[model samples]
Target chain A: MSGHMEITLNGQTKNIPGNASLQALAEQYTKEPTRVVAELDGAIITRDAWSRTILKAGSKVELVSFVGGG
Target chain B: MPPIAHQTAQDSFELGGKIFSSRFLLGTGKFRNKGELKASILSSNARIVTVALRRIDLERHDENILEYIPDGVTLLTNTSGARTADEAIRIARLARASGQGDWIKVEVINDSKYLLPDNEETIKATKALTAEGFIVLPYISPDLYVARRLVEAGATAIMPLGSFIGSNMGLRTREFIQVLINEIRVPMIVDAGIGAPSHACEAMEIGAAAVLVNTAVAIADNPPMMAKAFAQAVEAGRAAYLSGLPAKRPQGEASSPLTGFLFE
Candidate 1:
């Protein structure tokens, strides 16, 4: 059996492993995991739970980062 | 009457079909608390105050700052976080939806360090906002050409900063701003970097239709007292402009006339 999940990051939608947590995905994709903050369905997620929080088939997530430039 | 004197006395600016009573626009930021903010606003006699749109804490109903603002004060919602023209346009719509205000302070800052307005994005946003029937007042640097461009793009008024945002530099671009005042047909409001009431007065004396101050008044030892000082300075500046200042002379001349050869 194959598990697949759809997530939107920074306005772009992509398919990833369904069982993986947001933290693992963030660690794998982002260069600096600590600098990014994510909101799951409009609710802010704490940094510690990003990896443990399981994702469903379709979840809307927004990643906000503090950029240096104005 | 001298031309300079006649020109200096003109006060008030027409924007969004309303006349602003005071030439000093206030910002609702950096105050010790909401009560102080209200007091300062009242003391300043500023009819217009700028507010930023942010997610309200729904749980705490009493903590909202909006309730503290007194009635009859016009709140100008600013797009302080928007980095692009499109984002600013969206924020304006959201502000209108939330019943903040129809007037928008378009602030497109692409750089976080300086918080300078992105000229390209600002112009784009101004054009779009004006087209959407929103009153656009863009916060821009003291660039004479950019001020003219914004004015042409249907902005209600051109708000040129006196210096870098939050720098408290106090009219560092006096010469350039003076040029903008002389050239731009619309109301020229000097926004940002005003550290004192004297700075506000200086802006007014130099033909700025109004001056918007936030940090100076907000972070003062006594916000209310500072607001009062600003109000008086603004009024004094306006009065001086209207009364007409004496022509600058290289040296003091005797009013009694030292040389009476013609009469003799």
Candidate 2:
């Protein structure tokens, strides 16, 4: 619980402290963490819940944001 | 007294409990850059713009595209990457969580050849998303049964393609769209494959609630100008439809005096 752990963040492996919240992961990975939606194991982690959802080892995270699309 | 046609009524189309007078929905894709996208959208005076969700590059995330959207414009996020109902639902949820509105354009396209929308998956997504309180708009080929099913599934509106996406073919499915215009009760939005302003006009003239255009404007020499043209065309077509087009005749009919004109 005190050592660095790894999880898949947006298809890339990232090493962070054990029990890091999704918000922490987003801050480390995204330019604007406020505008992104984080998904863990294919379930959306709402912005308000980001602080409570902890990323476990081997967790699959997909950080999606709005882009130009037709 | 106001003319009967000009009387106060529901002159605007209502979708997701919002009223929109402009019958043009612009797509915020394929533009040369974000600046052009903003300019074109402003020029079109569209109240709603559609965007797609994408994986944010963790290493070097670009500027947020939402910043390009002007004030007072409603954002419509689309499930462009989803190929199934479940995937579409997931995307829709994430889109809503992004703090953008709950308006989602459901696009379930498993077909790679023509990029046609899968109506079955679209219906499934519509039902699920609508149940979750998201305003759902399902894009599909012009099919009356599918349109009715989408409506029954609680879709905010039915977006029927005029032809292949970005094909510039201009309403190849005219007769089928007319069938939707006739039968479907919900707003019928002509979404993809509109090539020109005339195409938008034609859709509006046939009583479509709106026309969503992207490639035709984005790829034009002057995107802003094209957007303005489309806006004007939509207005003209809506006016024409409202004024009631005259019935067609096989032979030419004389409008001026047939035999009494001084010039004649």
The estimated TM-scores of all candidates read 0.74, 0.94
lDDT of 1 by residue, A4-69 (tens): 777766566768887878887666555555545566765667777777788776677655432111
Predicted candidate 1 versus true structure: per-residue lDDT over B202-251, tens digit per residue: 88887788888888888898988898898888877777766677878999
TM-score (2 decimals) of chain A in model 2:
0.87
DockQ of each candidate relative to the true complex: 0.04, 0.84
List ranges where model 1 is wrong by over 4 Å: A1-70, B1-12, B57-62, B255-264
Docking class of 1: incorrect
How far off is each candidate at the interface, as Cα RMSD in Å? 11.6, 0.9
Per residue, candidate 2 scores C-alpha lDDT tens digits across B129-221 of 999999999999989899998989998888999999989999899899999999988888899999999999999999888999999999999
Q: Best candidate, TM-score-wise?
A: 2
